[model samples]
Target: MAKGKGKTKGNGRSKQSPQNPPPPSQCETLEEDEIIRCGEPAADGPRCKVHQAQYRTLYAKYKAAGKVVDETKAGMEMPSKEHIAQYSNLHSTLEKARRIRKYLEAIRVEKAGRDMHQKRFFAKADDGHKIRLKVLEKQMSAAVEILDAVQARAFDLHMADDPAREWVKNFQAAPLSTNDEEFFSAINSLESETDPQRDIMKQQRVAAAATTNDDTMDADLIDIEMRAKKASLLYVFEFVTSEEATLQCMREFLGPENANIGAKSSLSYHTLCQYYRRIVMHDPVLSLKAINKRRMHVQFEVLMDKRMDFGLLLWKDSIIEAMAITRSKAGTAANVGDPKNRFKVLGGWVFNTPHSGTMSNETWGTLLETLAPIEANIENRFVRLCNTFDDLITYLSFGALGLFPPPRFCSKTDAQGRDAVAPRNHLSLCGCSVNYNFLYLGHHPLRDEAGPQGASYGLKWRNGLTYLELFEMSPMHLQMHSYPDSGQDLIYFQVVLYSDTDSKDKFECFGSGNEALPAIQTRTFEGPPASVTNLPSGRGEWEVQLSASDLLFGTKQPEPGYLTLLTRPGSSGWFFHFKKMPVKYFVILDTVPHRHHSILAKHVAWTALCTHGFGEGEYSNRKYARASDVMFQKRAEELLSWKPKGSWTATKMGD
Candidate 1:
């Protein structure tokens, strides 16, 4: 103890080593304008965690203001995670609104039920229910108003961006028709700045118009524009080197450079054609010879005879007769006189391309003028008689076998007390119901009613040609017409065997080569169908020969919805239902067969009643039962051998 006390004397100024200077104040740095700071020092760094967080937030805010960094600026900093999130919030609101609209649409059952119930309640006429129904209806109306307002706002918001405007502009420039492909393969080609939110907005656009009917035409046009934009984008991507190249081509083709072109000159069509030309010219994979031989390049022809080649399928008189008969049979009053058959054609015509000079100059000139704009950029532009490959195949179907001659112009009243209007187009028949080339081959029922307008592009060919031509003049046309590739058995193979052009789509044909082509065969039945004494049940034999795979219920169970068949005017389109069900039903769409009857008839009253749950009225309920109380009834001795094994088994059936 004594020694320790003495050793403390050397640096006796309370030599506690200054008590190891107190640790730096355990507090965060105070902000410039703030008096107080965080109480504890941060585990890592000069400032406490709270102050660190505060600084990061402030830095992020400064960055989000889009302020660029400058070395000279003393307080410049990067944005914090929080600031980045805050900036994205603007777009997120729009996305959320889109999602909400989608959800609302998806929940349609609730809305439908509400509407139906409200209507029912209103019909009750009771004071209480009436008041409640009125309230509900008002609420629904208000809701619809709010929804419409929101949709308009969303559309405006989307259009505020440059990318959206560009998309819309291109879409409006080119539109797809009802006959065009339903889907565009190139919708995803262009990358837009606001693409992250595009999907939601797109759904909103379609859904907003889902319930609207008054603006149906405008909506349909908008839809067509959208589809065309997608198709154009894809077409450009595939054929053109880049979008810039496409734009350049479009500008050259559509601008004032082609002042002689018609006012109806199509920008999208030219863009596509130019792109094809560019690729064919530059790409080694393509050849002019090959392109010339393609279906689009070659012409198609159908041999016409008095009895074998009807220009169209359904004769106008026949359709009228059928409609009258059907109505009469259905217990409706109608004129019972027989319809005079005006059709006079009978055999399948040969299919081949015509030689040069075989087609008239008027035809060539018209084709050149009509298609020059479309084929201006092709390597070997030519107007083949088959205008489009589809015309050849479509014109020679069932109804066309009975071709009729065009009516003569009559100034005086005819035997029927009706004066005939002057013939306008090339078609000989009064009308056709389901002719594929109806637009090209026949007179439009309304032709006389319409003023002297130009014929549609499809019907511009001269009388000498069997097929329509779609191209203008080109070097290849001269060669094709001169050589006129023939003896190639066009029936067996889809394409001409003379060239290397590939099929535009997959087609099915029997056999393999030239040998297969020779072996291929077809059977035809002349005259009326065989008559039968007793008809079988359940639509025994179908008029159309559709494969089982084509049927709606071919291999599946019964579905909730009905199937649709796309029937043409003159063709007796058929559908086969292979699966047997407990009950069978039928619906018929009838068209009037007169000159002014071109307007498709709509079953308005029936449709309205069916929609309101008053479907087809009740039919008679049979009262007959088996004489024997037993489940099975005895058959005649002669028919005993034809008896079924069980309830599910049945006798053979066909008409």
Candidate 2:
């Protein structure tokens, strides 16, 4: 009986009754007062497991919030610290609640997944289950309340703490008046507050945008008045000298400077030539003949000879000053426009002379009469100035003489001389290289005095794909530009070279031998005209050399002539000139192919060939503003061996 009693008690059966007493209030809810905050289930003991877990979580969050408030309060002032501490505590509490809510939600998800996997979706849970879920709901509710309180507190604190933030926060939310006038007034106040110069800045921005398209930005508003003067040929001379390192190099190579040039001494042509030959093997007289046509177009040999030299000895300084003034004009002046107030010399001196274009016998006589009485550094100044001009030529020429002229062709005996070359059978497919973009034969009325009344054409070479070829062709283009302008109704199309012996510039028009009449044949065109009374006109492509020879000798026998445009005779005149025409290109051409040669060297040679044809001998056929070529050549030749000082050297240039 005793064992049975003990066993029953151990089994938790009531001692008084054998039947179960409604399970002895299995849930604490049945025994606890309705007023108790949590109705714990008896299975979970005196504490409600769900509510107990929530209490622990809330207590932990409260402790963490208190700690954070304490730490933040350590660095603040009394008033601010108090206020912020309160807010911080509230924020931490709210954060803790959020974490608890998330944890409970995760628990719910785990329960749901377990129930689904176990197929217990329809299983009935006891009051304990209900209480657990209810506790979670209550926790979420409390967390939300704390969150709301925290946010309200933080907002109040922020409003009192940060004015700028507060202003930004309320700006958009501030109410506007319903009245139109009040509304506009409020808007204006806000606008001014945001930007004091709102209207002005807006106007400025609009104006600036408008000016973006103004052309003035691309142009200079102030005009720069130009003083007419020549570009210093000294630079060109320097380039040539630099290429050969003329003076210093020669001095080093020859062991000593030629006392004749290095020191102030009267230098004759032969002596100067010797000095130059010894230095860099250059000759000034020959160099003058080469580039004289375009620069210093005067006979140096004749002017410097004996009696002429005597005349210069009397008026050398004046001539030097005159030449210096002329060079300063850089080809801008049509003629020496009244030499007075025109030329500036060393020592701030000024003088006058005859117009450069009127350098005739009459002008020379007048200049001599005016300058003979005046005394100056006649010999020294003249030599110095002439040397300067020579230096320019030598540098520009790059220390070289003329190229080999084609051998002369004797058709009668089929013998060729070193002076000239005949065309190997004139090909119908002849093509001349040009350096222009396009050739245009445009016409403008004479009544319209808008500059030149001539055609503008280009000489662009084709299919060379090289800069050297382009450079070689530039002279040709310059020649075309330099050619004499065809007068009104007169177009000088084809430039032909004839013997000076031909009185009328006439030749056989047709036929190969005696039967042939005067005619112009090119790579593409042929015409003397059906009748002699017609202006040449028609589209035709012709091959012509853009070279020195072409400039010196026109389309003549032995040497090949340039191909050109022509017109038929007896037709409605193409250009409408009622007389014969003289066609010429001021620049010369070399028939030898330069594509395989050094362009720089070739240009140097070319520069040493063309001269102003005032007379016969190479040097005597020209005019010079300074002293003799002898002095000039001496200086130029010295420059050939010139070396840069120290270790520094010059960077070379090309054209």
Best by TM-score: 1
Once superposed on the true structure, which residue ranges of model 2 sit more than 4 Å away at CA?
1-254, 263-338, 345-655
TM-score of each: 0.17, 0.16
Per-residue lDDT of model 1, residues 381-491, tens digit only: 121222332322222111111122212222223345542211111011111111111111023232232222222334443321121111110000000111233312223
For all candidates in order, the CA lDDT equals 0.26, 0.28
Task: Single out the weakest 10-residue window by summed lDDT for candidate 1.
Answer: 472-481
Model 1, C-alpha of 263: deviation from truth (Å): 33
Lowest summed lDDT across 10 adjacent residues in model 2 is found at 221-230
Candidate 1 regions off by >4 Å?
Answer: 1-126, 159-423, 426-655
* Model number with the top lDDT: 2
Error of 1 at 91 (Å): 3.3
* Tens-place lDDT digits, model 2, residues 1-655: 6565635435554465655455433323211112333333433443345433332333344334434433433442222333434655535544543554454344333333222212311224567655655654554344334433344444444335533334323331321112323433443443354233434543344434343221222311111000000111122122122323234333443456454233111112112222121111011222212221322221122211222333342243333334433345341222334433232211122223322231222223223333344232122222221222222222122211111121112111212221101111100001111211111101112112222223323234222111100112212211111133311111111122222224533431111232211121223222222332442343344433233333233453333223221123342221212212222222222223222212222232222222222112222212221112332343334433332234122221110
